[model samples]
Target: MIFDKLKKFDIVFDSPEMDCPPVFSSGDVVSGKVVLELSAESKVESLKLHAEGFAKVHWTESRSAGSSTAYTQNYSDEVEYLNRREVLLQADNGELTVLSAGRHEYPFSFQLPEETLVTSFEGKHGSIRYWVKVKLHRPWATVKKIKKEFTVIEPIDINTPSLLAPQAGTKEKMARTWYRSCGQVSITAKIDRKGYTPGEVIPVFAEFDNSTSRSVVPKAYITQTQTFIARGTMKQKRAVVATLCGDIVGGNRRETWHGRAIKIPPVGPSILQCRIIKVEYMLRVCVDVPGTSKLSLEFPLVMGTIPLHPFGSRTSSVSSQYSVNIEWLRMAIPEQPEPPPDYSSVVSEEEAVQNSTEVQPEEDLSGVLQRSLMAYVQEFRLRPPPVYSEVDPNPQPFAMRPRCMTC
Candidate 1:
């Protein structure tokens, strides 16, 4: 209990108005307070607080040479965007000799750099993190410290004309066995545009022609590719964010898909601003054929903060049919007829009379019986009556017993 009481320290942000997973961009001021509660007067040296935002990448590899010579190589990279240190209290300043046995609060603030910074990301090889740390210095004991981490997001806007332009790609591949043509699979996939925001749906149009002898399944997905470069060595990672698998296509048949959309998720935008990390998005469609190699095509995509305007708002001179083929396909897909009326809605007069007879009027016991039941319940109430008892207004104090005999 004594040690638990002596180790009390807390750091809290002053921006209560910010939502959970507090968000901030460049050029924002972050302020917070550090609180220390001492069970006894113990602190002697100084108190320091640090605020820092940085990205660090560390990876190691082992390389072996011929005949018993081996070496380990380590790669480390760090970028510090914000670093601020504040001395809250110091013994050399002669402000106070010893910390009192009470609570103390120190306020600190720092302005983030106006330059763009990478968003906070935690990957296997690297991480971009921002944190606030507080340290309590003592004479003979180890330093006591506390730290808190927060998130930093850099906004990427997609409102530019270049990002809003439509992106499309088509690829064709042939399969053969022993110099004889087995079949050819041709796939053409297109998106309304490259730019997209989180929660925004990406409309995909695909036409697959499978002239092969084997059955093929068409699959489409959005992938986030991250490229990390360190010391002239480049590493790449890819994650599929969304996918759509179409119906199987038989041999010598064409399958057209329209109105297929993949919604974007809350992922980091393209890492064009970061020097060592590069993030890119792609819309990939692959044809998986049984007993044969798969044919795939990828179209680059852009994820941004703003969603594209409606197709009608686009002022480009491109023909409407070329820009949005789904609108045309909507007219081609057969529409279902209106649903028939429900049985309850189409009740005949005789059926109505029968239903009325089944629903007899319910009895209303809302009069004297309800009153009597309520009265009976009130009489058996669990609460004591609020009657006043005569007692002395002035009372003498009594001696309290000790919690333990030793006390």
Candidate 2:
């Protein structure tokens, strides 16, 4: 058979059940086998298997001065974890004398660390990655190698009291032109607390006062800020993760927003511990006029691993209304299931599918090796926009006087 006359190199994971895009957590054991098949006898020096995890960030900036433009590149790489070279076959040890060749399987295993590893994240300018590699060494020919990547996620818990306390921010701005004063605008925004887990709703409260001659529009949004540091210089990228907008406010009128909710996503648990990268969240409220500068307020937020208590038990009726559009909110939150247990703990009747050559019928095996790589490439190319809820048409107007006496 043609298959019996060809050489093959493959890496197969030892899992009870075959999983597409296999997942692993911290403190887990990753075991697999490397298979080598050859129909003809060949010279061999050594065979080695390697596994590693790393994070890398890169970006470029361009600045124009007159008719000339300058471009600067920034990058950083961190090897979060690594396991190197477990020799499977060595000619120096005289284990193999290179007689007949058919199929050979070598088992390999690695125990991941229990701490300081974050979930795998792939962004436009940065990525956290893990991979396994196999190398075949020959005396006179170039070395051949195969590599495969996997996913790792670290659980985040948000049950801390500090993150649950109520948080608020206020900002007031006076608009003034060259010769005339355009009056003033004030904004105050608050959230139920600072700490939030993925898939949980966040209630927001805001009061806007438009004392200026021109009408002002009110907007609120959640922002995620990612910072990358390289060569002692820092670069930051910001994305609006969720937003809600209120109706326009007439001059001399005040508008109050209540029961507005924004849902957090599974993409975060914060990236503060990472040395080269950092992730932060914020809530911002802004009031915009036709030509004058806008007034804005900002409140810091924390993404955690635990969900808040029930609204009825821990919050008032206003908070209860936060779930007014529960169905819509559900669509925004991504599903985050718990990581599968170690392969040893699970019971299965069938043999490991990854070890079976029948699983891959295609002539080229590169597709199986590059599955994770392709997924990341697609993710970076087709990043999805943030989800948003419709603005409430009838926001209640506050009757109290403007908090800023000058306005």
- Lowest summed lDDT across 10 adjacent residues in model 2 is found at 374-383
Task: Tell me the spans in candidate 1 whose CA falls farther than 4 Å from its real position.
Answer: 1-7, 17-19, 42-44, 66-70, 91-97, 289-293, 305-407
**Residue-pair clashes per candidate, as listed?**
0, 5
lDDT of 2 at 125: 54
Q: lDDT tens string, model 2, 50-165?
A: 88887777766655667876666545666566555588778676654463578878899888887767656565557677889988876555678899876665644444677656
What TM-score should be assigned to candidate 2? Answer: 0.68
- For model 1, how big is the CA root-mean-square deviation? 29.0
Off by over 4 Å in 2: 1-7, 14-17, 40-44, 59-80, 95-103, 138-140, 177-179, 265-269, 289-292, 305-407
Please give each candidate's TM-score: 0.69, 0.68
What does candidate 1's lDDT look like per residue over 1-407, in tens digits? 22344656898887545433345669988887888887877645778989898777777778899989999988777778889899887867664447778887888888888999777665555667789998877766677889997656676656677776666667788877677778788887666566765445565566789898877888776665555567766555444555666789888987766536555544455666776666677777788654445566777887654344444323221221211122111111112133222222222335334433322122221211122111000001012212222222432221132222111
